[model samples]
Target: MHTELDFAFRRDGETVRSGGLVYATVSAEGRAAIALPARLVEMLGEVRSIRPSR
Candidate 1:
């Protein structure tokens, strides 16, 4: 499975976002709580997937 982590820079009226990719063995655990590999983090930067609030 895969997850897309985006970084949204804070702004007064506009949103700026950047994306990074990460992987997982399963999606059942949900992307929020998944732990990525340290090597991957070092190589690809930090990954944080965000979902819209319900």
Candidate 2:
């Protein structure tokens, strides 16, 4: 089976903004970062959740 995963980062001391949907490859080792916002580091602390496509 195949699944779609998404990642979003929220930095500390800053408003947690939606980083938007990201395309990742799912495998036994887990999902890998294929493409994501460059601002991920800015919102590393404010990351609310990594919602996966159901």
Question: Which candidate leads in lDDT?
Answer: 1
lDDT of 2 by residue, 1-54 (tens): 222334445688554654454433345566653344445434444545555433
lDDT of 2: 0.45
Candidate 2 clash pair list = 10-43, 10-46, 11-43
Model 2 alpha-carbon miss at residue 31, Å: 25
Q: How well does candidate 2 score on lDDT at residue 20?
A: 52
lDDT of each: 0.54, 0.45
Superposed model 2: Cα runs more than 4 Å off: 13-49, 52-54
Write out the backbone clash pairs for model 1: none
Against the true structure, what is each candidate's TM-score? 0.28, 0.23
